[model samples]
Target: MLAAHGFVEAVEQLASGLGVSVLVLSLLLIPVATELPEKVNSLLWARRGKDTLAVGNLSGALVFQGSLLPALGLWLTPWRPSRDVVYAVILTLIATTWLRLANRSGGVRPVWLLVNAACYAAYFYLLTLR
Candidate 1:
């Protein structure tokens, strides 16, 4: 925990020095750094034919990170989210609900995948906004 905190502080300081947005850096780099190992593990599991395990781990990580990271930010930081972040969160919730509804029939359809891709594009658009 201490090392993670130190790393975050270091990254924030570096962002400050570079005149970059700390939120942007956090959104871009921190999760990628932390999740790479799990992603590698998922790939290895897939190679071993444990498709369920690989997918479960990937989805579980997404849910855990999506919920916990935002909750932690609300708890640990001033919690003054910019308008974009709030919109993104709302969009996420809506998309998640829509996905749940779509999954009720047991399997995903092609249109659902396209909608999810569009949602991802929208989220990335939110992030890339200046």
Candidate 2:
């Protein structure tokens, strides 16, 4: 609806805060919102004592973010991303790859969360540098 209403840019600008507030807010919010439904599903599964189901949902989410969505975005967007946008995407790729690799080791380690935190920090730092 925000996109169809011609307010995508406006909402994104407001969310990204027009250079006054850090654009990291937009980046951080994106994954959280995207993962929220999966998290909700996992939480429901956990409540039913289905820890494995929760883990499966998390894995599915990681795959969706890592592969499907980004591929679709690239296929759909008409123009190439700017250098800064590309750099940001590179950061995302790095973070997501690291996450997938970490998940392969059989548990969510503290370091993975820390890496994500560092990614968020890097996003804010880049916004500041911008």
Candidate 3:
């Protein structure tokens, strides 16, 4: 708990130094910290030729986070959709659609993942506009 609190305090200080709100900083950084381990595991599995495990590990985390987090947020919070939330949802849908189309066309090539990265870049750009 102390470590977590210190981590957040550091993030807050960094956000202050960077002249951005802690919310924005957290949005930018926290997901990377949270998701990096799963992504690394998936990459390792893929390199080992465990394609199913690689995909499952990545998709399972996405599925759980996508469904449960929103459900909990809706249940626990007032659930007002801000501009940021709307933009994020729209971007997420766009990325999902892009991935789906890529899957339908053929296997997901490494290059195809660039679209998702572009979506994330778009979100970061959008954040800057606020």
Candidate 4:
């Protein structure tokens, strides 16, 4: 979370300095770049055979992206979410619930990966409509 704040601060500073269409470009890079540290941390854990930590990091990211990030949007911006955004939020809630159940039962089958792909497609479709 602090890393995300630092990432946002760095991007804002760069955008402010550039003073052009810098925000558009910087925002595009921010997500992937901000993930660098987490990726490295996960990779190191995996290399040491600490698989659970690596997996937990990935799962925590999913939860953060789905929940906390959207909450931040509401707090930081005056713009209201569209109906599609509301639907996305509801769908995310359902997905997270399913994830919790899977985690509890150790029932996250390989076939469940297909469901993830479907959800990803649906997310983009909703975004296009928005």
Best by lDDT: 3
Clashing pairs in 2: none
**Clashing residue pairs, candidate 1?**
none
Question: On residues 56-105, what C-alpha lDDT tens digit does candidate 1 reach at each position?
Answer: 99999988988887789789988777866675677767777888888998
Error of 2 at 126 (Å): 2.4
lDDT of 2 by residue, 1-130 (tens): 7553554465467766654443444455567766899999999999999999999999989998988987998898886766557657888788888889898989778856888778767766776675
Model 1 C-alpha lDDT versus the unseen true structure: 0.82
lDDT-best of 2 and 3: 3
Task: Give the per-residue Cα lDDT of candidate 2 at 62.
Answer: 91
Ten residues in sequence with the least summed lDDT for candidate 4: 19-28
The residue pairs found clashing in candidate 3 are none
Ranked candidates, highest lDDT first? 3, 1, 2, 4
Distance from true location, Cα of 63 in model 4, Å: 7.4
**Pairing residues by index, what is the TM-score of model 1?**
0.62
List ranges where model 2 is wrong by over 4 Å.
1-10, 16-25, 96-112
Model 4 over residues 1-130: C-alpha lDDT tens digits?
A: 9986887787778778866334343434665775678888899999999999999997798689657986898789997766655655676677767777776776788776666567657765665563
Q: Ten-residue segment with the worst summed lDDT in candidate 3? A: 21-30
